[model samples]
Target: MYGINSLIKSGSLEAAYPLHSGTYKWTVSGPLSDRQIYYKICLKITNYEMPRTEMEFDSSYIYKCYILDCINHFGSLMFFGFIMGRALDHPGVVISNPVSEAFYRNCAGLSCTFEMAVLQLTIWFVRSCFKMFTKLIIPYLNVKKRQKQHDSKFPNQKLRQWESDYLLNKSERYRIAHEYLDTVAEYGYVTFFISSFPLAPLCGFLTNIMHLRIDAYKSITLYRRPNAKKVPKLICFTKLLQATTYFGILTNAAMIAFNSDLVPKEIYRMYYNASLEGISHQQFSKIPTSTVYSFYKYKANEETCYYNQIRDDNQNKTLLYWWILAIRFAVLLGIEHIVFLVQGFVAYMIPDVPYSVQEQIAHQKKIQSDRRETEFSFNINRKKSVRETERFVLIK
Candidate 1:
């Protein structure tokens, strides 16, 4: 990909007339004619049948092209999970990066502060830009490569003429769209962002502008007009979100534990410094609740603390970190139990057959069993008779 597009493309530049042909389309077209003229040429010779209207791909049982759509729907679930794992398992560019200097840098190695939030947001913004550029450029390059290969095989042809007709009975209008890919990618991005940076959803307000506009530009240019289907909700992506809610909890805990200094130094040392001062949970709970402190030198007039002074055993100021873990575990178990209970209740609520119908069903099953047994016996006797007749004829 040509790395960055610092140069702007605006309609106002049309009258410059620097090597400009007097054609309006040229002025309106891109510096790269791949989208305008080349694409139009490709469309002209494309091997598709003429239809004024669009049609759906065959959904009949015979060919079952709809099955491909169904498979893709489910495949997005695993794809999201894979993206989540890869993203979170690595050292993040923001909070996870180790700091070499203490006072030398503006922000700490780890803290849920505005500095860290900004850093995380900036990283996601850069990533969004890179992803946008790649999505726009790579497909066109791939298509161009394929077009060349087609030209080699069938000398005056393009992809339009590469095939006689659509792969399915309908227009190949059912081509894959950016929406499905973007949806799944967004699922992973959101989960990872929430898990890593709580302020990520807020940060999305900025990055989405770049993402939406870039996607709109590509849709208008690089890609073919796809047969539009109205998808109400992405079922697999919704289920993935349900799974990642729990996953986000784990990642958040990990980030707090491994990377951040949210826990007090004494408590942290007890856990990680391998101090022989073996501490018990009872001692931890009794270790008098401390005042939550803020290292931030500046605060607004409406400064308020997130958590109240803890008077209970489980309400340690760090949201009693252990209590949070325990509560999450309990909630997970409760959800599973509720789901099972609901399933059982639904099964019970299903209508039962009338006594007469039940009796009729049982009687029909019995008749079928008897008929099968009779058929088996007849088959054995018939085979024996045929064998005996064949032996007699051979002897004769």
Candidate 2:
């Protein structure tokens, strides 16, 4: 079984599983026997195996695939956030003043995030629609072709009716190993660059909600019944999420310190006792530029420009520049430490397993032990009784 699973994973084999019956009519008509119903209920309760019926199998497969896709979508979202931040950092779009630059970047980040959310949702929706079209139309074309062939082969005989399940297109299979890769990537994006765009969480939430419904619909109605398999606990996915979250904290801290004017504004407020608005207008010096011929073949007069950076007459960085740089680093370090400490404290306070669940598990163990003892005692008594009967027979 292990080898076959490995082979399936490697694509050497298509699939190896108990085939489901090709229809769900039995569920409505009533199962063949009580045992069949019992098995169906057990399959539903345990979720250890999928039902050997087309509708149940397809439903289960669709659900599992939808979960996997959602994970992938979230990971992609996170990655998109990270990429947006880095991509928007080009010099062409950035302003000269620190405060203005931060404001501009924030606005741009928000717009991009919203746009990306929309784009992601649109793509998923369009893909689903296309799949649904193919699912409904392709099978129909195949049925027509089959009918044509039958008519030519047996002109006098009546055509046989085909089951709907037999006429539907086969479901497309996906790789389980690569299922969570997109999710990991999106998670990294969302957490790592969350400071850049605060609306990311909301955008992610909306996307997931819409995506869930779309996926469910596609799985149940558009795709053919797929071979269902049991999914084990996703330890790797959990660990990846944890890793991304921790790393995101650090990235957010860095973004807050370096990408925004928060640290500089705070430092100025502490040392100079000046307001951010006043500093924006009065603190920076402007450099005048000479009139020059434009590259586009037009002469232009250049005006004075204001910059957030401080430089001397010789174009060297001033003492204030170094000071602000040092302070930024300090702020970054402090933010990370503070956030990490809070995270650790919270984690410690909240245990992984709830107390109620732990008590229930203990209770279950006790019941099992009691049942074992009762069985053991009953077996011993039965053996003694048999020995006594044999002795009585010999005496007689």
Model 2 residue runs over 4 Å out of place are 1-163, 166-169, 172-189, 276-278, 281-304, 373-396
The digit string of per-residue lDDT tens for model 1 on 263-284 reads 3344535654545233222122
- Please list all clashing residue pairs in model 1, or write none if there are none: 46-160, 47-160
- TM agreement with the true structure for every prediction: 0.31, 0.54
Best by TM-score: 2
Give the runs in model 1 whose Cα sits over 4 Å from its true position. Answer: 1-126, 138-178, 193-199, 229-235, 257-396
Error of 1 at 154 (Å): 18
Collision count for each candidate, in order = 2, 10
Q: Estimate candidate 1's alpha-carbon lDDT, on a 0 to 1 scale.
A: 0.41
